[model samples]
Target: MADVKKVATRQSYGEALVELGAEHDDFVVLDADLAAATQTGKFKAAYPDRFFDAGIAESNMVGIAAGIATTGRVAFASTFAMFAAGRAFEQVRNSIGYPHLNVKIGATHAGISVGEDGATHQCNEDIALMRTIPGMTVIVPCDDVEAKAAVRAAYEMEGPVYMRFGRLAVPVVNDADSFEFEIGKGILMREGADVTIVACGLMVQASLEAAEALAAKGISAEVIDMHTIKPLDEDIILESAKKTGRVLTVEEHSVIGGLGDAVCAVLAEKNPVPVKKLGVNDVFGESGPAVDLLHKYGLDAEGVERAVEELLA
Candidate 1:
């Protein structure tokens, strides 16, 4: 596991923004004094004229991004997940979402992986909160390749977008040369028959590892990377559930409004199946190492393997 090359999705986001900035000049970036943390600093440095630091006020940053978007320019507002999704919910929902503006929110340091930042910075409910707003496209990239692709896809699309990037350096799962990304689509990481493991963000790599572990245990566990939460790819989920008969959702965020609930909602209406959730169980995160937090909160590969085993039992 340690041998695999790892890169934080936030870092990928920054590099992707810089690439986009070089290609286009109609887009602008706004940060809530968290350019370095959110990885928008790369874009800021490359395109200083297009980048605007809105100080530490996340809400004000959203308002400014919305205003900029109204002027027919694509606005990418960046901040920690806690501030971008939680603190600026009202402004985002009212000013951007209500009007359906072309604004992309780059939310970094999401979930328990925020580590030493503790519960205050670890945003477990950001996905749930963002899911509530109408026409909000929520995306959680799994690896560096996926994260970079997601950023570019969000920029090409219209309306408001909420993208979550992790602070922890995760394993590179996808082959960069062949990988393709699309909004509201889920990627099949592994094919199996006994059970299905649906995941997003860093959890996708964990789920893939868990699937391999399950394979050794004589359990065929399929792995699906549900990168886009809102407008979820229900077709892929239903197909997997119909084939496996059991579905398990894994995420680094809360078990509440994250990937689990989104999958459950789809299955409940279209294809009902026995489902299990592996994530932070409505609890707060503490200051610790990023890897330790994932293990402690049961968001690691071992935890995912255990969940799959229990689900099949």
Candidate 2:
């Protein structure tokens, strides 16, 4: 696995923006002085005329993007997740989300994977905040392939799309040539009948590795990438839970209002099953190395495998 190719989803978002810029001229990008870190600098470099720098005001940047959509032009507001979803929550909910504008929010460096940036910059609550906005579509792609496709899909669709991109380089688990991405649709990565393991973002690859470990122990775990958080694919969760009898939800976020809670909500309504949530234990992140932080927070493959064994026991 060390030889496997890895790419950060934030990089994918930047590359995808450049590709989209070449194909369409109706969309403009706005950044809040973090264009380089957010990877929107690529789009800025390519289409300088179409890029807007709103200084350090993320709220104003979102508002500008919303204003751009009024003229029938799509706008992508790029910034770190903490600012885009946290600091700009009022503007995002009122300016973009309330009006249901065609604004695509590119939230990069999301989750605890933000590493040494610590709790203030590491956003584990963005998904919950974004989902609360009416008609806002939340997407957390698993790898480079899905991240690029998700960005393209958000552009083609008509509505406010909140996309979360990671700072950590994750394994390219999906085959670019064979993979297909759809908004609000979950992908069934590996099938099994014992227990279903659902994950998103960097956690998706960790879930896959956990599945393999479970298989070695004769646990037959099913793996799913719930890329789209809002308008979640309830049918897939019900179907997998029906077959597996149990489910586990994993994420690089807080357990309060992320992937785990979203999946549990569906199962509680449609089908009742035992669910083990593998994520941050309702706590803030500390400054540390990215890989070491994930291990400490129990968001890695070994942590996931251990959670599954405990759930089964």
Mind giving the per-residue lDDT tens digits that candidate 2 earns over 1-313?
5788999999999999999999999999999999999899999999999999999999999989999999999999999999999999999999998889999999999988899999899999999898889899999999999999999999999999999999999899889899999998899999998999999999889989988988998999999999999989999999999999999999988898888999999999889999999888889999999999999988999999999898888
CA lDDT, every prediction? 0.93, 0.94
Supply the global lDDT for candidate 1: 0.93
Model 1 CA deviation exceeding 4 Å by range: none
The stretch of ten residues in a row with the least summed lDDT in candidate 1 is 208-217
- lDDT string, candidate 1, 87-149, tens digits: 989999999999999999999999999999999999999999999999999999999999999
Q: Candidate 2 at residue 160, lDDT?
A: 97
Off by over 4 Å in 2: none
